[model samples]
Structures are given as C-alpha cells and as structure tokens.
Target: MDRMFRVLGFFTLAIGLMAFAGDLTEMALLFFLQTAFFVILGYMKFTERIYILLFWAYMFVTFTGFSYWTIFQMGLPL
Candidate 1:
C-alpha cells in the first residue's frame, strides 16, 4: 500500500514534468505539490483504512476543485 503511494508520487512527478514542458506552469506546480504530498504519505505509518479514506478525500477535493475551475473560472459553455 505504501509502495502504491510512492508509485503514484512518481507518476505525478512525471505528469508534472510533462506539464512543465508544455508551459503549463500552474498545473505543473499543482502536480509537483501533490507528488510531494504522496511521497510524504508513503513514508508515514497509518492503518490501511485510513489511507483509503484519505485517498478518497483527496480525490473528492481534486475533482471538486477541477469542476469549480472549469465551470466558474473557465466559464465553459453549459
């Protein structure tokens, strides 16, 4: 499970690097922060259920933020 977090961190780092190359600095920074977060979580000791819950909470927040940005900030057509 911890290994999974590290893997996710690396994947996020890769995405961040790609974003940076594409000139999406803000998105790259976001992914870089998330990569650091996942790496930190990977080193922490916690119950499996807690990790799962934390991940779900993370997903919810990320999705919600993305939705809010796309709808409100970006002003996409409905």
Candidate 2:
C-alpha cells in the first residue's frame, strides 16, 4: 500500500509538471496538492493516524473546488 501511494505521488507530480508547462496554473496547483497528499500517505508509519489522510483529502477537495469556483466567477475558460 505504501508503494502504491508512492507511485501515485510520482504520477501526480508528473501531471503537475505537465500542467505547469502548459500554463494551467489551477490544475498544476491541484495536482501538486494531490502529490503532497499521496507522498504523506506513503510515508505514514501507522494506520492509526488515518485522520491525517482525511485532513489532506479535505484540503485537496476544498482547495480544488474553490479554485474552480473562483475561475468560474471570473469567467475564465481554463
């Protein structure tokens, strides 16, 4: 499971880099946040601290949602 998260983290990092190269700042930021979450999950030494994952998930979702909302509000078609 740890290996899985590590792989996902690398994948997300690649995605973030691509987004950055494309100048898609919102997506790049979102993917970067996801990468951080996955990396943290991978390094966790105990399952008892699952709340950390929950916090990261909440952050990823909330931040991404708000990013989209702000973009929509600004009428940007990104």
Candidate 3:
C-alpha cells in the first residue's frame, strides 16, 4: 500500500513534466511552479501526509480561478 501512493505520486510528477514541456515561455514559469508542487507531493507520499497535498491542490485551484477571474474582468480572452 505504501508503494502504491509513491507510484501515484511519481505518476503525478510524470504528468506534470509532460504538461510542463508543452507550455511555452508565456506560461512556462507557472508550469514549473506547478511541477515543483507535484514533486513535493511525490515526496510527501513517503511521509504519509497525502491530505496536505490535497490542500495544496485546493489552493492552486483557487489561485488559478482568481487569476482567470481577474483576467476576464480586464476583458482578456483567457
């Protein structure tokens, strides 16, 4: 069971890297930040605090939402 979470964590990291690679400079920094977050979560799997990772996920989502909201208010396409 321990190994399962670790594998899942690595999977998340892989997905992050894949997405990070496709992003251009305009969004590259954000992708790198997100990839780093996933890397942290991957390590956390060994420490048994997966829930903390979920909390970060929530925060990221909230931040992204606020970003888009602000952009929309400014008459941006996305």
Candidate 4:
C-alpha cells in the first residue's frame, strides 16, 4: 500500500537521522532502512512506473552514500 510504504519511508528516514550520532551499528541500521524504503517503493501497487523511477533514484543516492561511507571508513580518498 502507498500509505504503508510512506510510513515505512518516514520511519527509515527518522532512523537514519538518529544513526547520525551513533557508531557502525547505527550506520548499518540506517543503510538497511534506506535499502528497505527504496525496495518497498519499487514494489508497491499503483502508479508502478513512477514508483519504479523513484525507487531507482533513491537506490542511486543510497548506493553512492553507502560507497562514500565505506571509503571514508577505510580511510580512502573520494
């Protein structure tokens, strides 16, 4: 459902914000939350094309962020 996915997205965003002040555990949690949010959007019913596009966009952003975080954690340059 659209409403369900929206709620989940909000929840994940909140968790991601909270994770900003924590350690690896929080970061990992945030990563999973973001992934789930996008995946849910990708599969939700109604307006499938738009939701799919948005899902890919979110995936790109999340993947880039995750890659940057991993690189930073490894003390590597961007």
Candidate 5:
C-alpha cells in the first residue's frame, strides 16, 4: 500500500513535469502539490483499510470536482 502511494506520487510528478514542459504552470503546480501529498502519505504508516479508504476518498473528490468543472465551468461546444 505504501509502495502504491509512492508509485502514485511518482506518476503525478511525471505528469507535473510534462505539464511544466508544456508551459501549463497552473496545472503543473496542482500536480506538484498532489505529488507532495502522495509522497508524504507514502512515508506515513497506516492500516490497510485506512489506506484503501483514503484512496477512495481521494478518487471521489477528484472525480466529483472534474465532473462539476466539465459540467458547469468549462465552455463546451453543443
């Protein structure tokens, strides 16, 4: 589980690097923050169930925010 968090942190860091290369500083910064968060979580010792719950909560929040932004914040073509 801890390994998984570290892997996720690395993945997000990669994404942040890519975004930075693309000159999307805001997106890069967001991913950088996420990378930091996952890395810190990776170092912390927690129960298996707690890790699962935490991952699920993170997914829920991310998906909900993405859905809301796509639906209401973004300007899409009809």
Candidate 6:
C-alpha cells in the first residue's frame, strides 16, 4: 500500500511539473493522471472513507473546472 502511494505521489508530482510548464496538452494529461492517481489511492485505503469521499469530490471539481477553463479559452459561453 505504501509503495502504491509512493508511485502515485511520484506520478502526481511529475504530472504537476509538466502541467506547470504551460503546455495545454501536458496540463490536461497531467490533470487526468493526477485525478486517477488520487482516486486509486483513495480506494486502496479502505479505512479512510472520508478521505476517499473528499478525493472523489475534488476530482469532480477539478474536472468541472478544467472543462470550464477549456471552454472559456475557446471563447465559448458558460
């Protein structure tokens, strides 16, 4: 379990750096990867129900925010 978390963390950090590099493709990919990583991590820890719920909530918000940001960048309406 610890190993899994470590791997997820590593990927999350790597994706985060790539996202920060200002490439839209990389940023989108990173957001997806990080979101998946968090979901998996949350599921693996069965004892932490609250954490899982929170992580899923965060994922939902992140996805929505990204979608909105993309639409706005494309000059679309809300």
Best by TM-score: 5
**lDDT values, one for every candidate:** 0.94, 0.83, 0.61, 0.66, 0.96, 0.66
Q: How many angstroms is residue 29 displaced in model 6 relative to the true structure, after the best TM-score fit?
A: 14
lDDT of 3 at 24: 52
* Predicted candidate 4 versus true structure: per-residue lDDT over 18-68, tens digit per residue: 676566576757656775765576456767567656657867987998799
Candidate 5 local lDDT, 1-78, one digit each (tens):
988999999999999999999999999999999999999999998988989999999999999999999988995779
The better-scoring model by lDDT among 3 and 6 is: 6
TM-score to true structure, per model: 0.93, 0.60, 0.42, 0.45, 0.95, 0.47
- Residue-wise C-alpha lDDT for candidate 3, range 1-78, written one tens digit per residue: 345445555665566566668765445555555556555655654444655567567679979988997887667663
Q: Please say which candidate is ahead in TM-score: 2 or 6.
A: 2
Q: Which model scores highest in lDDT? A: 5
Model 6 over residues 2-36: C-alpha lDDT tens digits? 34455666777677766767666766676667756
Which residue pairs overlap in candidate 1's backbone?
Answer: none
Q: Worst 10-residue stretch by lDDT in candidate 6?
A: 1-10
Sort the predicted structures by TM-score, highest score first: 5, 1, 2, 6, 4, 3
lDDT of 2 by residue, 38-60 (tens): 89978885464564575577679
Clashing pairs in 4: none
